[model samples]
Target: MQVLTAVPQVLSYVVALVDEVPEAKDVKAGWLAFAIFIGLILAVAFLGFSLVKQLRKAEAAEEAGLYDPSDKKPTPMPTVEPDRKDDTAQNGA
Candidate 1:
């Protein structure tokens, strides 16, 4: 009857609407973003590990008396000779 015919028409219209939607064609960009994110994470992890190792090495060195403690008198800074003539005379007021 008319009701059965209308049901098929409605179903076809719904199917057409579903088919009209565009499929995802740029999946590679998503993968590239994921790869970059993972690389950043690994880089940060590597830096953290390096920092810990260096800190441990420094602690060990301190324990071995390789460096003097700051509680003691500081070492004098070495004096450096000027490499160039003073520029004050060149700048006329």
Candidate 2:
């Protein structure tokens, strides 16, 4: 009986305490954070889809022989001729 009587008093105190607390004022900040999170998710999804599309295009191009690594040979750099007058002076000609 005493416990039951004390329970109501505790409940009333809790209700009073809750009523005295102030409501949140930064609700807009919470909404902004959620918007930013959703935007980042959308951006990442778009980037992933684009990357896959580019990879598929590249694969198709490779299969069509548009990019043949084995047939590509590196061109040699051109050699520069020395000046004839400079060479003659060095040789004491």
Candidate 3:
């Protein structure tokens, strides 16, 4: 099949259609991008600080016996014991 035959022609046509393409040097992360980056950094820093503060508070609460910590798992429910008599009778039958 000549399925891929038009690929090269299409690529060449696309290249020809393009009048100009800026050099790599012309591309830049402008002030808007820099501002957004700075904003993200500040947001992360704020969240980190807030997280630390919350963790400290949680530690204090745990020390004061307000609530149990996640590391300490809750006591599991006791498993039900099967009737030994029924099991023995069934086996005998």
Question: Which candidate achieves the best lDDT against the true structure?
Answer: 3
Please give, for residues 1-93, the per-residue lDDT of candidate 1 as tens digits. 999889989999999988876568833457889999999999999999999999999889988888867755778999998788568866853
Tell me the deviation in Å of residue 37 in model 1: 0.2
lDDT of each: 0.86, 0.87, 0.88
lDDT assessment of candidate 3: 0.88
Tell me the tens digit of each residue's lDDT in model 3 across 1-93.
Answer: 486998999898898889677799998879999999999999999999999999999888888988856767789999998756666687896
For model 1, give the 10-residue run with minimal summed lDDT: 20-29
Model 3 scores a TM of: 0.54
TM-score of each: 0.45, 0.45, 0.54
Candidate 1: clashing pairs of residues: none
Model 2 agreement with the true structure over 1-93: per-residue lDDT tens digits: 899999999999999988875567733457889899999999999999999999999988878889977976788999999756667788898
Residue 35's lDDT in candidate 3 = 95
Model 3, residue 12: C-alpha shift (Å): 7.6
Deviation from truth (RMSD, Å), model 1? 17.8
Flag regions of model 1 displaced more than 4 Å: 1-29, 70-93
